[model samples]
Target: MAPKAQTPSKGSKKAVTKTSKGSTAGKTEKKHKRRRKETYSIYIYKVLKQVHPDTGISSKAMSIMNSFVNDIFERIAAEASRLSHYN
Candidate 1:
C-alpha cells in the first residue's frame, strides 16, 4: 500500500514551497496589494492641457499618454541614477 501524503491544515501557517532551483520561496510571487501613489508636477499638467488636437482627446487617451510619459521618465531616471554613481 502507498503512503498517504500529509496536507497542511487550515489553521496552520502557510508553508513555504521549494522551487525546482531548490531555493526557499514563500509568497514572493504574490503582487503587492497596495499601489504606489502617482503625482505629477504642475508643469506637466500645463503642457498636457496646452497640446490641442483637431478633436479633443478623450480621458482614456489622456490616461494612456500619461502612462507612456511616466514610463519614459522612469527609464530616464534609472539611467541618470546609474550614471550618477560613476565619476
Candidate 2:
C-alpha cells in the first residue's frame, strides 16, 4: 500500500507558500539622475595636436570645426529621438 501525503491544517504556518509572481509591496522605486554629456571638441583638439605637433590650428578654424561637429551631432540625436518615438 502507498503512504498517504499529509495536508497542512488551516492554522499551520507551513500552509503559506511563496508566489511565482513576486510581491513588491514595501519597496520604493528609485529615479536615476541624468548625467551631463561633455562636448567632443576636447578630444578632437587632442587628435589634431597629435597628428600635427608642429602645425597649429587657428582659433577661428577650431571654432568652425566645433560648430560643424555640434550640428551633425544634433541632427543625429534628433533622428534617433524621432525613430524611438515612432517605435
Give each model's whole-structure lDDT.
Answer: 0.60, 0.70
- The 10-residue segment with the lowest total lDDT in model 1: 10-19
Residue 62's C-alpha lDDT in candidate 1? 66
Best by lDDT: 2
- Give the poorly placed runs of model 2, Cα more than 4 Å off: 1-40
Against the true structure, what is every candidate's RMSD? 13.7, 19.2
Best by TM-score: 2
The RMSD (Cα, Å) of candidate 1 is 13.7
- lDDT by residue (1-87, candidate 1, tens digit) is 223323444223343323432343343454357987674544455675688423355567667777887999999999999999995
